[model samples]
Target: MDTTLVIRAKDVHMEFPVKNGPSVVALERINLEVPKGQLTALIGPDGAGKTTFMRLLCGLLDKTSGELDVLGLDVEAHSQEVQNLLSYMPQKFGLYEDLSVAENMNLYADLHGIPMGERPERFQKLLEMTGLSEFTSRLAGKLSGGMKQKLGLACTLVRSPDLLILDEPTVGVDPLSRRELWAILKHLVHDEHLSVFVSTAYMDEAAMCEKVYIMNHGRFLGQGTPAELSAIASGRCFEVKPLPGVAMRVLQSFLLADSRITDAVPSNGAVRFITTEPNLEIAWLVKQGMTPVPVEERLEDSFMILLKDDEQELAASSLVIFADSETETAVEIEESQVPKSDTDMPQLDYLHLTGQTIADDAPIDIEVENLVKQFGDFTAVANTSFQVRQGEVFGLLGPNGAGKTTTFRMLCGLLPSTSGVLNVAGVNLRHARTQARANIGYVAQKFSLYDTLTVYENLRFFGGAYGLYGDALERRIYEIMDEFGLTDKKDEDTSQLPGGYKQRLSMAAGLIHCPKILFLDEPTSGIDPLARRNFWQQITRLSAQGTTIIITTHFMDEAEYCDRFMIQDKGRLLILGSPADIREQVQLPKADMNEIFIEIVERARDKGAM
Candidate 1:
């Protein structure tokens, strides 16, 4: 291995015993060389051996077979030495809620046995770098999600190790924090010459790395610099504008069902697709009364093409995806049912199941007037007002601690408003909390399922709590199992299921009663692109069925799927409108949601409103 390589691997194979079944292979003959003083990324979906590889590199999980080296030391023999020379930040970094940020930083320093004389300089540098200096006195639990992640990073870097390994560090964080965290990593790599290796589901994050390794089913699918890999998608990528009278999702689902297209997803109000036959596809697009536009190849596009093994079923076309979404079942339509003209496009079999909501006459399902929530002297949500129409996919977005979750909880009937009028499913939340809850299905930020329980048992518990009984509960449980493609995992412990399957089961439990309205809090957080896509497809299907969906997400691109969305900060509404409305308000009508969100939030901060 080259002396400059920070870590090297050869023929790495990892497997875990599965009790009653054969051993499960986590990694297979993996080979990788991470360069020093640079950023390297491992990209993969859940159960793609990413976490397994990370653990092996850290010597936390012994490999079945492989040669692994970290900083020129054998990880197996000098695990302590390797661990001492590097920092590892897992998805869940333990931060003591009772301790302040400064206390947490000191705790890590003590754990690493840093010299007392050196503590001051290291803590100051880390605090300034993570922008947590001002919040040092704040308890870890009091910090927002983004701030907590920053504190965690600061703590991890207390010893200033030569290398840093992060597994999805930015998961569930807002765009602003994500950008800031990357800045810290880039600063460390370029200025301090620290080697940073990370695993992330975000393609944009991977594109920033100097080297990216795409993995799936425990094997390397592809590896290269971002630009080098992006070149693979050249000429295979193109965009098609939605035909008149056709919903973007309708066209996307239609395209996803076609085997001719390799991948198709909604972006910036149009459908971006990959196909081997670009010219033929363009001609086909034109004949469909849509304009085909050539687009630049992106790392994400190439990534999908490489990890085609865990490929989303073409039958699982999604209405929206943070990265990708595919659930098990497909809503089938007869070939003859396909519309012959662009104007007749909106009428489809799926649309019939969820009567097309393009109409403006849909009844208002959620109405909040001057909604306010306060704790002693602090206002978590103040004077926030919004309305969601029947079948509308409404997005609630904010920076960490921005009160979107507070508003969501109010609407879900979990938290009683301190004051103000709140109505859900035509029931005044203040007067009929239980009735409102009965009509609403809520999926919390942290999935509210018992990990020790099997999928079947968890469903039964959630259903029974909702008053489902006997054959009604049994039939609904099986139906939901089939709906989310979880029938095979019914008896499996929830903890043993893959991240994606757990997400499906969580959603199933929420919708067991087929509630009139569904509330999802950061539903797509920490999952892979494939799972995100599948989750959104289900949301899309439900919305089409006249199910009002109220969701909060840190993924800005998902705003496209929402009919309307609201952004709040400092417990106040900063912006409220559709994607177009937001872009127009930010004077970036053509910009994506991330840009719009950053602009709005920063502008609010600048105005001292936040």
Candidate 2:
């Protein structure tokens, strides 16, 4: 009932009937209030009701119970009015592919009824702000992922709505692009006093918000600023640095073996664990007969501690209910009915390479010399050169439109280089495109698999296209399906699969041919962290078997998995070395790869690299 609140929800509940009986609650007793002209972030893992809440706020979905209001209007009763003052950018914004950037802007301007006199200036400013001026004539479909996101943001801002709802706006955007988007958002808030509500999986972005609502399984668990929420673990955290080559899984097991441990999570190079008793301190080093070093808690540690507390409380309540059963005849299920292990599950190995050995003398898998790709007068990639040694995990790291994909496409023979020497498996890809392509595997940035096809059928078609047939194809397909944990869902239509499974299927299809080298173009884009870890495991295993990998990723953590990399900016190579080397060059003490990447890109821009 606060007068300054632009969005107010009270005991909101949304449910959908399922087959057989009970309705699935997508939102349960959710209550929230957003003050005017403030940035509020909704943070959670996948299937956490973030999207459901956003849809409800935009009046795209109706609440099953309770009241919801936005901009002083009832969401359900004054839906039209609410819609007029709110702008929504769904995860998959409906951007027209065939239209040029300028044409797309014009179409949105018309749809929003933007005044003609103000259109030019507004469009020009947006273009300049988003760095899309040069790409105005390019088709929206041809734009890079980050550029497309910026365009979507620009289109949504055309009418200057009072409330902006962005669902995972920066999901796959590069750090530089994300920072730019944040800057523009700050400007909008400061200059126009606009209220912003955005949903994101990135914790870093959540930290930037004035307030954050943490949701899980359609329920609001907590709400507060970053510092306030992080204070939940104020005195209960401990950091442990394991010896070299000590797997996180092993460390996690060691922590969980102790009843005193409340939660454990891997961060950076250490494992942060929280204890049940805040005053309890265990010198793990002393217990293990080793030296100990002082450690500190992080925001992630606090979040995990809170999550674990919720889980334990739920488990305890369930146990009490079972103990109070009315039927005397009912056999006491005891602990047998409960899961023997933690239901929260252990984190998967993001990078796991088995004893699969690489041939020492295998030929250079990929070789590029002075590669140049130009679109009219603009050079997308200029004088780029690199080589992927046999069994190596190579990476192309760059900001949006820094020509990473262009270079990748040229290597894959999807695009002919304007000028330069390129070879894949020692064959000139430009001249022997088909032959070179036959020896390589590729997964594009977007979901490239057919939507209507079932998982099995998609794999079948891709396998056949790669020249696999009969028992060999069938055997390979099943092996891959099992390997990627898609065996049971093979009959399910691909489009019906979750975002993570779709990514897994894409990876399986790409590897069906068992090519000597694999090219992954942002292969983990839009997938959750757990799925990304699984995908990386597959990649690392392939690499260990001498299947060279050329990966492009915006996730800096993923970049750490690469053995060597080339960092590019505006079609020029900025740093080319090992991940450790790049980190060292950045020289930001205690900075992770993401921070280092941001600093490098900004520094380069200031030096006129962009």
Candidate 3:
């Protein structure tokens, strides 16, 4: 690799003072370099300081210590120049919701001082490239989640800068939108020689980058190509399929029990375990009389190993400098002993299946017959038909731009179907929009709650809108607040809560009126693993209470919670079945849901289903 660097940081550190005394280290001794014209990815879990680094590179934030340079210019000394040369897309890039699509683009162009002569050409090209030509008149706030993201990207690309920095650009985007975004990015890098630095949690996206920097705890753990990183865990991973209801928790317990196992993570009904020792055999599994099958090392498995190694290294460093002998002894003692509760303990009801049942002969909660939606010459949803049984968790699975959102809008009475019949809760959505909407609740892909309103206020407003009032509404709101652990934050503004809590509030608001059916569009996107588990618990509880849920998610493992699902591509339905049934239909020897989804989409495309 060439040593010429466009961006460099040496021993950078950033610390923010908390309320009390101690400080929170956002970045510590971070060292990274981005060669000109290469795509460099900063990959890690949430709160790993990827955003902090991006801010530093773009001269948006000052480092507490150390040196930083972009394009041979000091970040602190030449902030204006760096800002001129770098284009940044923050996690929440300011998008004017009130403006039309074209108006927003024009606003960006004027702010950037682009020449009038170049503006028209650039604007036209961008519109054509991003497929936003026809939607120019649409209000930014009215666009779909994926469309909004594309618009954001287009706005940032209006000017040709030396480097482009995107923080979690595809975080909550659907698979199709993700692919489209990547395609645009790849084209820019290849054709325009654009130097791209992006942060992502998706392992597949990381694999496609020219180089990757894996970070944890505000520090870089490793830097390499995807193949090089996976090589670190070669021949050390094993896949285990335990009995029903035991796969995930059992594997988690085993990883906690055995120090030899560097990592254990759940993936589509199985656990992938990685070990560092080359000669380490599966003695632990054999002792427990369980069988283990060797499996290929994926990028996620490699990331897990890297995280574990980093954790151990931190532990060892702490031990070496400990001043108290008791503390060191405690560390050693804890390392040698596994928690008693983890061994042979029964698994919690992770699914949280509540005991509520809808009438077996109840009318279908949602029915779509010959539904179609069109945009000029493009058909988004074409003659799609399905029925969702009452009390069932019906999943809408599809690649990006598969018309899922369009279909969802029609069902919710937010959009008029081009043709066909649609019914929700025994009411035709087209003609009886008010009655249909009253019986259904919807959670959009983005955070749709008021940012300035307190949690309690938001709940109160939503409850009131649903005809909830007086003491009854107050009582229900309090109950929900307690149930979701948001009672303490009831007075805090919705925007002030963390991402997880905000998600909980959104779910709570959707269920405040106890509608017969709920619609969730990618509800768990950008949520952490632990929070995702809790969110699923809530979903299970709702299902048990006889609420029909129609949800769409890109997280394949979540499909296991659905009663049945349909996978769509473009405007066509590809497959419809339960999670297990879909797996079986794929017919791959060891394929999981993610792999199965990939296979089905690819096959559908080959067969012209799109």
Candidate 4:
């Protein structure tokens, strides 16, 4: 037992048995050491056992075989003690929506058995640290996504545990708030001497940590400081100037398909890639008419290259075994057993989504003029106006509570606007909300599928809702399932599917009717890099096939996939343009989307705008 380390795992291996198939290996020969008073990051593609390992540390799941220690205590032998010595915040931190901020903190304090005398000082400090001091009276449900996360963090800190284990803490948060949370963690490490272990989808966040561990296929790929990991691709990275009129995503897709390239992604108005063979090949570049410019590798570049080299992706289903029966039977549950989600859903009937010849004149598909939505005395969205052209991918971006969702809902015709001229697919939204929705497909921020249903059943239900029945609907469902790579898992239980598959299922259902325009709200939020890449490829395909796409995403890299993007802050549209245009507007033409976004938002705040 090393007293200097907060967590130490040696020869850790976790496996779950399936009654009818081979046992699922969640972790294999895992070893780790987290020194006291340091921040450690756990990053991997989806179903690489990140959350599983974190759960083992928190004693939420018992490890199958291994020596696990937390604060010098054997976790398996003293599960309760280990839990009491640390705080574990899962991705979905439980916050009572009906409870006020102060009330939520109090509830957590009660759960952790914090002394009443120590509650006030701790609560006050946490509130101030999270920038939620003035919102103590606000109900948790009323808070923005960022504020809700802050409140969850505050609640977790009520007891001042020795270690903090956070799983994907900034998954769906906006850029600004994500930075804020990291700042808070750094402060805790330096000022309060707290040891932290966290998982995150953002590579930039992992780069900020003192140590990073990359995992794939339930095994470790590499572990080191950001600089050390980045060195893996030191001589293999290059930025290619895209051909004229070629979209960045299209260029990325092309580069990725080549056998010589390990990975290629959108980067600051260019396509960045790593070669399977070392160094730049000038002859190859010449043949393709590409000007190769060598560039330094970031932590993400190393991660993607490593994953590709590993040649494994748990893209379809999670490996975790859910015991129902010895024959691997599923519990009898209907689609109604799951809670309902808000997706206008994909429809193909009203307007053609099937291989239609896109007209040369790309007319506006969505036109929003003077859009305004008021909730009591508060303006959820101001007089906002924007247009999305036919077959284009447009992105809407903002911090939490900045009215991104309000605008999205308006466009989907799920909510009526207080004042605005909204039109979609040539239909006036204000006058024909239902009719407008018929021409659009929607996949919300969260996975909008019935977990209790099978993949095929969920699609069947949604297809029927959209007036697709009999062979036409059935054929469309199969076509979509195959298109999104869900055909093999058509009969699999939806709830048991991996996070990435759920994302695919959501996408497949939304396109069942092949709606002319698709609205995706944070579709790739919590999924891994591999899953995001696949999702974007589908989006790119759809855009090329002439389906207009309007999406909102916090991942700047994903935003780069857009043909044009609109930035909103405090219910006001701040900027709208292509990646190059926005970068130039922010005086950061060479910076990435993340840099440009922060600059634009910060300038807007500094100008004293709400």
TM-score to true structure, per model: 0.94, 0.80, 0.73, 0.91
Compute the lDDT of residue 38 as modeled in candidate 1: 95
What's the lDDT for all of these models? 0.83, 0.75, 0.76, 0.83
Give me the overall lDDT of model 1: 0.83
Ranked candidates (TM-score, high to low): 1, 4, 2, 3
**Tens-digit lDDT string for candidate 1 (378-465):** 9999999888988888989999989988888889998999999998989999999998888999888898899999999999999999
The whole-model C-alpha lDDT of candidate 2 against the native structure comes to 0.75
lDDT (10s digit) by residue, model 4, range 1-610: 7899999999999999988999999999899888999999999988899999999998889888889999999998899999889998899999999999999999999998899999889988999999999999999999999899988899888987999999998889999899899999999999999999999999999999999999987889999999999999988999986655667776665555444677777887888889877785634444546688899889988998888778633322222111111111111112332112212211222113322333447798999999999999999899999888898889999988899999999899999999989989999988998888888899988888999999999999999988899999989998888666677888998998988888878888888988999999999898777667667777777887778999999898777888889999989999998887788877887887887888888999999655
lDDT per residue as tens, model 3, 1-610: 2237788889999997867669989899988878898888888655678888888888889999998999889999999999998889988877899999999998988889888899889988888888899999999997766788889988998898888999988876766667778888898899989999998767788889888999877999888888888878888888665444342433444443354666555556565677667546665455444466787776767776776566533233322111111111111112323323324322233212222223458568888899889988989988888888887888898876688888888888899888998989999988889988888888998978999999999999999998999999999999888667688888998875767778878988998998999999889887644345456656655665578999999877677567678998888788897666687788864566667777888898887844
Q: Which candidate number would show the highest TM-score if scored against the true structure?
A: 1
lDDT preference between candidates 2 and 4, better one:
4
Q: 2 or 4: which has the higher TM-score?
A: 4
Off by over 4 Å in 3: 1-3, 15-25, 92-160, 183-193, 215-237, 241-291, 302-364, 372-380, 413-439, 467-479, 513-516, 527-534, 537-547, 555-561, 569-572, 583-610
TM match of model 3 to true structure: 0.73
TM-score of 4: 0.91
- Where model 4 places Cα greater than 4 Å from the true spot, the runs are 282-284, 287-289, 312-360
* Candidate 2 structure quality by residue, lDDT tens digits, 429-448: 87899999888888888878
